[model samples]
Target: MHMEILPFTIAVPDAIIDDLHTRLTNTRWPEAELVDDWSQGAPLAYVQEVCEYWANGYDWRTRETALNRFDQFTTEIDGLDLHFIHQRSPHANATPLLLSHGWPGSIVEFHKVIEPLTDPTRFGGDAADAFHVVAPSLPGYGFSAKPTETGWGIDRIAGAFATLMSRLGYDKYVAQGGDWGAGITTALGALDPTHCQAIHVTLAMGARPKLDKELTPEMHHALERLQFYRDWDSGYSKQQATRPQTVGYGLVDSPSAQAAWIIEKFWAWTDNDGHPEDVLDRDEMLDNIMLYWINGNGASSARLYWESFGKGTRHVVTIPSGFAVFPKEISPPIREWVADSYTDIVRWQRYDKGGHFAAFEVPEVFVAEIRSMFRRYRPGF
Candidate 1:
């Protein structure tokens, strides 16, 4: 099959920006949550403040220019234009690395880490630690064309990504991801072992609780966190999985609705003190939201959950895999829980800080951990 790759740039039309502003101005807000904390949802006041800043203070052109500094392209893969940031390293020996983003995150989450990973020497690190980074906005998210058909699940997405690596002329590569990206990366490891050599992830979606044996304190804590997620944090998941189209109406129409939808996750999932702003400033947060709003990706993105939520059959990765456990991760799965599925566990590092958005929350640590896992697997190592 002949794949056509074309250079792509982020140039949202002025009309779109104007429309967003108009929508923000005429937003019909609801009554404030009756709670003091974020237990109910993103607070009415905070959402309003962010929307006001988004309308007046945020500068899309400036952010667009910064993102355009990296080379981006779109290639037709499996009947969809897959958008990706392909930043090659100066070092001749740099290994190919594929980074995938999950829900509520676009390629914006990788902005801080891409350059550092690609050109480590510029960041005062060894060039040997460098990677030829290929960060792709997943199907139905960001600038990538959304799936019109129903079967774009994890295994299929993994296969498409493998085809992407081949088309990029990379016969071998390492992959990393978090959240839904983790599921896709795991599938890539199992399904494309011929090309995808190793995998690293923060989330292990296939992990099942060990109820037949005695549970340790770490396991107990992890289970409790899982329970908490089921009780409180998973409402969005349920809604998206069951009725994405229904929620997409609000998310696509109202900029404030989209902002609140994603911003709530940043606040709940990050290792922040009280608010998401403590970890990510308003610009950084809004930059991500614009990917959804600009593309009107609310419905398309949520449809990924509907497509693959309970249908993941790919597990038991045979390729070398690494798992980074962040302290405040939604449910920090211990090695034992995931060991059965991710068989060739090469490295499992647990950190005291950070959360689900590892790359965005702590780029330095994320870069170092990535380098550590893939260094030994580099060509001719």
Candidate 2:
């Protein structure tokens, strides 16, 4: 199959921006949440403030220029037009790395680490530690085409990503992801072990520890966090999995709704002190929100949950694997449990800070973790 890779740039029309402004101006807001905290979802005041700034203060051109600073391209893979950022390292022996973004995140999550990873010398690291980075917006997210049919589940998405790396002329590469991206990366390791040399994941699913046996302190904490997520943090997943279209109508039409939907996760999931802005910049948060808002991917992105979540057979990975356990991530698996599924566990590190969005929350730590894990397999440590 011939794949045509064409240079792509972010050029949202002025009319679209004008439309967004008008919609923001006319947003039909609801009464403020009865509670002061975020237990009831994003507060009315916070959402309105963010939306107002998005309309008048935020500059899309600046964000677009930042995105276009790197080389981006689009290609047809399995009947879907895939979009990716391909930045090659100056070092000839640089390893190829595929970085995948999860829900509520786009390629924007990797903006901070791309340069440091691709050109390590420029960031006070040796050129020998450089990597040829390929960060792709997952199917139905960002600029990638939404799946029109069923069956674009995690395994299928993993296969498509393998094909993408092969199409990019990389016969061997490492994969890294978190959230839904972690699920896809683990699937890649299982589906294409020969080509996918190793994988580093922040979220390790498919590793069910035996609860019947005595649990260690770490195991008990892991179970507690998992239970908490199942109880409170999984409402969005359930909604997306069952009725994405019903939710998409409001998200696609109202910018405020879209902002609240995504912003709430940033608050709940990230390691923040009272507000999301404590750990993440307000503009940076909005930059990510705009990716979903402009693409109108509210429904298409959510449909991924419906296709794969709780619907597929789990595959055990045999290839080398590394796990970075961030403190505040919703699902933090114990090393013993992760070893049950990922047979060849090479590296496992725990951090005191950072959360689910490690790339965005702690780029330096994230880069160091990636470099450290692959160094064992990259031929020269």
Which candidate tops TM-score?
A: 1
1-381: candidate 1 lDDT, tens digit per residue: 548889999999999999999999999999999999999999999999999999999999999999999999999898988999999999988999999989999999999999999999999999989899998989989999999899998888889999999999999999999998899899999999988999999987568877888998888878887889999999999999999999999999999999999999999999999999999989999999999999899999999999988887958898999999987788997898888898899999989899999999999999999999998989653
Candidate 1: residue 15 Cα off by (Å): 0.1
Looking at candidate 2, the ten consecutive residues that score lowest on lDDT are: 372-381
Task: Tell me the whole-model lDDT of each prediction, alpha carbons only.
Answer: 0.92, 0.90
Steric overlap count per candidate: 0, 0
Best by lDDT: 1
Candidate 2 per-residue lDDT, tens place, 1-381, comes to: 549899999999998899999999999999999998999889999899999999999999998999898899999999999999999998878999999989989999999999999999998998878899999889999899899899999988898999999999999999999988999999999999989999999987667877777888778777888888889888999999999999999999999998999999999889899799998998899889888988899999999989987897677889999999987888786887777688998998999999999999999999999999998566332
Whole-model lDDT, candidate 1?
0.92
TM-scores for all candidates? 0.98, 0.98
